[model samples]
Target: MNETKLHDLIEKMTLEEKAAQMSQVVSSFIHKGSSDEKITGPFAGMEVANEDMTGSGSVLGATGADNLRTIQKAYLERSRLGIPLLFMADVIHGYKTVFPVPLALGCTWDPKAVEESAAIAAKESAAAGLHVTFSPMVDLVRDPRWGRVMESTGEDPYLNGVLARALVRGYQGDDLKNDQSKLAACVKHFAAYGAPEGGRDYNTVDMSRRQLMEYYLPAYEAALDEGAELVMTAFNTVEGIPATSNKWLMRDLLRKEMGFDGVLISDWGAVQEAIPHGVAADNRDAALKAVTAGLDIEMMTPCYVQHLKTLVEENVISEALLDEAVLRILKLKNKLGLFENPYRGADTELEETVMLSETHRKAARETAAKSCVLLKNEGVLPLRKSQNVALIGPFAESTDLMGPWSIFGEEKDVVSVRTGMTEKLDTEPAVEKGCDIEAVLPEQLEAAVEAAKQAEVVVLALGEHSEMSGEAGSRTNIKLPDAQLQLVAEVKKLGKPLVTVLFNGRPLDLHGVVDESNAVLEAWYPGTEAGHAVADLLFGDTNPSGKLTMSFPHNVGQVPVYYNSFNTGRPKDQIDPEDRFASKYLDAPNGPLFPFGFGLSYTTFTYSSLALSSEVMEENGTIRVSVNVQNTGAVAGEETVQMYVRDLVGEVVRPVKELKGFSKIHLEPGETKQVVFEVDEESLKYHHSDLTYTCDAGEFIVSVGPDSRNTEEGRFSYSPAGRSGQE
Candidate 1:
């Protein structure tokens, strides 16, 4: 299955046969499930017959070793060239032993944990016979109204880029050809799919090319640099062109510039969507455009199967282009070792042993514990086992902790809050459902109050339902539901110590809950071990170390708030503190409710003595910055030390602050440590207004601290090569 063999196979393929290799269909089309199919998005009204799909090179949504084996065997028998079908699925966060959603995992800021979670997912998926996973969706998102934010790693390009590399390493492992607990990683929704207009899904994205490169494209490039084998096209339009067939995006930026020579697949039905997107006249034109534009696979659509061969025959598109696409597919198959063992990692016995094994669940629990961010703590947490606790709310005993994109996770296997507490506390906590997610009956409210009266402390479990924040789950109002808010208000009247634990997908506006509760914990939809992880954190068994990767807006009006914001002409940090002409919000602060890199821990850390290696740096030379941090409180905890840089003067305006580096370190009481950061030419480079990637000679400021808002600062001058404009 080397290059010689792959070339021979492609040469033997007929035009129709090569076209079939570029088509993909859902598993349901081959093995119909026993239920009324739900067609949610652009995939509705699409149909594929067994005759049309038998030769398809790949199948989506097919799971289980037994099912995949059957489907793959049937496909190879009719494949004409004996090519095995590639089984792919959306193993976004987890496959069976579901972990916290990507957004929640991002809060951990622990690349090791993020990588371990993906490794667990890879093991489970590989045992189920999946060869490729449409995952590590490294889209940088700032707007919470976009339902797909749950699938992203949050807004910062640097953070998203770092996590993107971790995920690819975990999924692909050190060697994809040799690792059985691995799957080919497919970094998805290529080229700025996260920033839709008004935070709406699939809306147009209008931005300058420099903005796209500076803010959006870095994550995808990072994933490719990590050796991801495939890339999936975005469903939205980029610069007035549908991403599925945009030549500038697919060719100039992605291929020629970024040097990504991997396979490119369209998101579900995106090729056919080109017609509705107004770029193509019909299916034939859509197929031609996508193929010529560098797309190698058409997912869940008949556009390629029906028209690709005809387009080639009519000389509308080059036959060599079709062969190139077919060759890429064959090369991937060979790399997977599918040419030797068609059933590469499929083993029914191994599947049962590894799907939800105790070892895997332990990793999930540990990761979930690290992901829970302590938003506000008024000395009410670290609950004593002797106290009588009341666990009240809809999620008290509910097992639906796994959020969207957990396609294979079964609710019956999940542990509930009550179950988790029972295992940790000496006395069984009183549990009562105060209300549904969106409604509170009068009787339910009374029962909750009675339970609170009987207990020494009350723990309120609350959040959006699992269906509220995934694909197409956008919400105009990002506040807690009225029912949950009303329940909090009623419980606050009892004057009992209140601890609120939230389990939503996106960053929510927590004005009501934060005001009512003495403590708040953002426990975003922790998967299989949701209850256990929450219990561990509550009982002082584990320290909360998670920091926010995405900014929590003060309200819905500040939709795209983040740590890195351009310094506008009317600066908010003006010379005159009371200046009314500055850019300021009358009703709310310009910053987020919780800024990026912000989190509270059980212990406190103090920073002092910022030092720099030099006052001036020459081009191509590195500058070292150092700070002293000490844990002053009487407890052990972890702290994320963040570093920010600002170009005081630039050719074009720059953000007030940009996060360049960060480190997560553990400290015991009275422990002191020195944290150092190095800055070089790459750290200073940015996309200029004229689209040139360069760094200007100017004064630069560096800050280091616990978060972006509070930091100790120092300044230096940077001079580029052969430029003496700045002294």
Candidate 2:
């Protein structure tokens, strides 16, 4: 469809017909091998709409490939328009070849791996006639309790931007129109949906404009900057207004301010829910408000079909707005080649060719390997090959390993840590379940103790079930669930050195485990070959080189704990160093259990003096800060070189410090490399009340490190060095 033809089609649509295209329905199809339907949806609220007018069709992800095709054909054939309706699904990590969910993927801090995983997901999703994926959710999440946090790129704006751009490019590629291996990338919750109050799902977020722009909106901006065709509005309200109907956020910030020339979609039935948000009186009002606010599509919000016509007749929404939104949908159809080739993605041969290919699994494996973060290691790893080891816990061998939002993932295909350990171990370690996390038994305790006692070291594998975290999985206490702590205490009582392998989706408060265990690995639900990746890390086939993208709080009460908090007037110590007046916690550290940008490698590294190219920078000058990073350990390793900068003197009080840049580097034993980060006014940029970004002429300190606690510091001054580029 060219411009003229697409315009003609839009002009021909009835108000009802046009509204029909706005929202999508979630339908379940009978599986090839099973009669029971798969229960998948948000709160399972889906209309029983058995009709489909678009030909690309419906999806049955749980039904397997064969049945998904059958259902798609049914939906396509049932359509009178022959317009080929697109099958949109959540292909977050992999279609069949599952990889770690987005949060874990961010930990790998590997953009290439993220891109590769998206490509693999695209291949499998396209095979299933999935024209678009509501994925690569680039929401920048600092709080972990939001179950959907497992689905987002972690807290760092820089990292989220990098990964978001990569995922979009990977999913759609350079030319999406003809790329059969591609599926459209839908960057979701267009504004700041990630900073849900208290990290609870669907909670209201009343954020300041500066905080929203600085911390939360970067990834959405990055995705749009990468040409993402669709942007999904969040379910929560921004400030006091529902995001789906906030014209300022939808039109001004996302469109005019950010220059996003794409379709805007609601997250599920968010448009109609605006009524409940106290922003609208009824569905008709909600529909009109959403469209006027630039919501191009309603997603699963059926209120569009029910009320858009009346709103249009009443002049509640202008025809021009309707045409604009409808055309955005048509434009995507044109790009997808859906107008001329409605079934472009629905090929039987291609479907058979692409689902979970060996190539795809290899990507999943590599992604899984990269996401494994070694939180603690006391050289109890690598299994000491010939020694006896105990792999105890429900998750050790039991396969339900897919992380959060694994709507279409297959459990049988997941690589179990038990399998990986057995294959890597020279001797078969005894595998036993500690008392089930959900169920404790007296007999189970005896079994757990027996396994731990018989082994030289116990690898205690434990974590929340897939349902315990991510979307609707919010809990006030994000401690290890199922009383797994009880099991951990029992196993530790065996007097054996213990290593813990955790697989929860969000950040967990593991004070007891951290205190008692000799080693800990935070493997946030590594996808398909998760077991193999854990095995690789445990046995040193691959040393875990991942980092904490989100800070780990010692307790959930320290909600929203981050690395860059501002100091009170009390300061670190003022007037009384030993008194409670100077920022001392009455009962807490006033910090995180593990700070952000913290990670360990099998081998240790040493940092040298910071060398700056200049002490003072002019408007056009660039300062290069370099440090020598020497791999001091006996084995090859990798380390993330973190750079943090502080505004020593600011008109307004500043944070303690902020992360400016980082680089992941690999080194062999004894090899030393000079790491340099280029700094300019850009590193010092901040938003002013005038709503513009500017860097002041003042002194700035830069620190390079493995963690924020430890750093190699240097000083520089910027004078009349105003920035002239985008922030």
Query: C-alpha displacement of 465 in model 2, angstroms?
Result: 0.6
Q: Which candidate is the best by TM-score?
A: 1
Question: What TM-score does model 2 achieve against the real structure?
Answer: 0.94
State the displacement of the C-alpha of residue 416, model 2, in Å, after optimal TM-score superposition: 1.3
For all predictions, the C-alpha RMSD in Å is 1.8, 3.1
Candidate 1: tens digits of C-alpha lDDT, residues 40-128: 34656564452466567887777888878877777667667899888888899998899999999999999999999999999999998
* C-alpha positional error of residue 180 in candidate 1 after TM-score superposition, expressed in Å: 2.0
TM-scores across all candidates? 0.97, 0.94
Whole-model lDDT for model 1 versus the true structure?
0.88
